[model samples]
Target: MNAYLTLGSVALFLALVAAVAVALWYRRRNDRRTHSLHQLLELADCLEGDLKTCRAGLQQAHAVMSLNPDLPAASEQEARHAIEAGLRSLLQQRIWIRDQAPRASQDQLDRAVSNMIETRSRLGPLLKALDQAQHALDDAMREHIIQRGPEA
Candidate 1:
């Protein structure tokens, strides 16, 4: 009888240990998932900031274009910089969405990537506009300079 009790006690102890091990593993996994979610949120924030920066740049470019049909090359350069930065941010955001989105479907991921690519695509026209505006500005500046004969 004593031997049977000893054996039962041993089994119970082993079962308890197994339960503890499983709980610990589950807890650790949950922690990792939480950490990943936090990282994803940070990536989203970065993406948002990039978008805002790009929007501001576009606004500036538009204002310059509206105010002066002949924008300086420098002004166009600033717009280009903003567009590039925006593109980079979009790419980074897509990467994060692809790699870290929790249980995201492949179709969903593909759609997200496509959206980001589309956003990047729109920049081409904006960039062209900036270039054209800059050229016009430069020509205007040249014409003005000629008229002023270096006095203005």
Candidate 2:
């Protein structure tokens, strides 16, 4: 009788240990997934700031182009439209990310984040074009000022 009771107690203790270990594993997994979601949200915010900066640069280029008609008209127009389209797309992406992050599965979050990053790469060309347009506009304005003297 005593041996049987001892065996049953040991079995119950082992079961409790296993249950605790499994619980801990699940908790850690949930934590990791939550961390990934937070990271995605942070990246989305940073990208939005970058897009805004690019938009501002494009606006500046447009203003400069307006003030100096001799600047590359075609390039300025292209840059403006490209930046506008980029902003629209970025906004849409941010909306999707925000809407989906909270209740998303780990695999889905991973794919969404990776895809967002890939799409962001496309914005690089648009930003580069904006920079080039700005430089050309600045050069034209400088030349005009120099030709007209300090007082114009």
Say which candidate scores most in TM-score: 2
TM-score of 2: 0.76
* lDDT for each residue of candidate 2 in 34-104, tens digit (9 for 90 to 100): 87777777767767777787878867867776776665555666756866776787678667777866777
Which lDDT values do the candidates have, in the order given? Answer: 0.64, 0.77
**Cα-based lDDT at residue 55, candidate 1:** 61
Candidate 1: tens digits of C-alpha lDDT, residues 20-118 = 999999999777666655655554555565566556656665655565444432455675676677667667775766676667644554555456556
Q: Please give the lDDT score at residue 126 for candidate 1.
A: 63
Q: Number of clashing pairs, model 1?
A: 2
Clashing pairs in 1: 70-137, 71-137
Stretches of candidate 1 exceeding 4 Å from the true structure: 61-71, 74-100, 104-152
Worst 10 residues of 2 by lDDT: 68-77
